[model samples]
Target: MKLLFNLLAFTALIFTTAANADISENSLAPQKEANFAQNYLDRFMQRDFDYVMSLIDTEVAGTISPEKLEEMHGYLPSGKLLSTELIGSQVKVINDNWEGSFTFEYHFEDGWALASAYMIRTEGKISIAGFSVYNTPDSQKELNRFSLSNKPLGHYLVLTMAIIFPVFILVTLVTCIRTPVQKRKWLWILFILFSVGAIKLNWTTGAYHIKLFSFQLFGGGAVSASEHAPLILTAGFPLGAIIFWFKRRSLIGQKKKTQKSQTELKESDNSV
Candidate 1:
């Protein structure tokens, strides 16, 4: 049992490492798009409208004057650009070219801003298609952080279920290890290790995403999309555990019956 568990752990580690490597390498293509978006945001923050406009496609640039662009920046968060973070990116291929949006977060001492740069590649030249910047005060960001206070009633209910599910799964697991089964006992152990559905809850928002059919290693967990994001609670139904509990009595009965029959056979042979 120990060897089997160690093997499973090693295999899982290798697969997870490989998947992470692939994701890191696959992001290179989008890095160029991300850089372009960052450049546009820098120019906008510097009030260098001409430089920003130069990045836009010619036809689109003609539609808005630099003065109008400056006016659009009214009430925008103003502070020394302390740091910029690339928070989101998506690209779609068109023929051989790609169009995408790269979103960035600009953090300041008292406020923050989200700037999304939408760009398109055509005839081998990249140009901005559209852009948006939303300025938000730091207090709003604080309200969104992971915290126990001010949460909705649904959040607590979901959290309670998430906690309960994992505990139930673990208790069933321990019971199965101690219980006796007639045959292929190892197979039952393996089955009891998995949960067979997914329920994901956004800890910050009272939202849930559920999949009726899915395989999860653990019954429940918590994670965050990014370092700064609020926690997300994920859980699955302990189908294996439930089944094991239901069949446990039958397994124990079978084992006892097998032992009794063996004793009777020995007694009959001795009499003969």
Candidate 2:
């Protein structure tokens, strides 16, 4: 009976080990795809053309020569990445090859942008062969609401909110002790306007184009430049303003404290 029990325990152990191995393999599949995507993006951003080419399948590489690839890479600026987030992703197997589709949101010095790329596996390495904008139908609707061609409405709205919002916040915080009532009202109004304008701009400029106009006289570059300007002005300007306000407030507080201490010292001397 003891020998039979030992035999059963050994069988259970074998099954458990096999189950764990299968689970681990399943988990690593998605993680491998995610890492491959990240590596490709990192290399591309660094302008490592040789490394990028090495990852591609020989068939795909034959379609685009090294010279053309280098030229294509030259078009992109060495942008400083502010932040990156993987929004959503999926992977599928097609005839012994794996394909991964991922959406990434990137914030740069210029502005915020979104991208989706398809990575195909060939000979144990993943390569990016195609990409497209990841904007949904709902995103398009929001962009239409901010149509710049229609009138000065979009232009004025963007500019006014960019300037007014930061200025209002800074002024209110600085003068809160002196003009509390007026500051409170302006702060509330500015907060609402800023939120609306930010959402409108985000939808309009889904992602800043890395490759501008290869097709026509208008060129992709033209649209990219045009869209990027407002984004930088709206987001970048406010960020800088906030930093300046904080620094200025710190200085003002220190000065007031120094003056108060000086007054106290003088009063103490008089009493003595």
The C-alpha stretches of model 2 lying farther than 4 A from their native spots are: 1-29, 74-79, 114-116, 122-125, 131-272
Q: Pairs clashing in candidate 2?
A: 212-220, 212-221, 213-219, 213-220, 213-221
lDDT of 2 by residue, 160-267 (tens): 654455444444334433322312445533432222212223324443222221221100001112211222223212332354345545546666777789999999
Best model per TM-score: 1
lDDT of each: 0.73, 0.48
Following a full C-alpha superposition, what root-mean-square deviation does model 1 have from the true structure? 5.2
Best-performing candidate as measured by lDDT:
1
Candidate 1, position 73, lDDT: 79
Q: Tell me the lDDT of model 2 at 145.
A: 44
Cα displacement (Å) at residue 89, model 1: 3.9
Off by over 4 Å in 1: 1-32, 57-71, 90-100, 122-124, 139-144
TM-scores of all candidate predictions against the true structure: 0.73, 0.35
Q: TM-score for model 2? A: 0.35
* Model 1 / residue 65 / CA error / Å: 6.7
* Backbone clashes in model 2: 5
Candidate 2 displacement at residue 24 in angstroms: 22
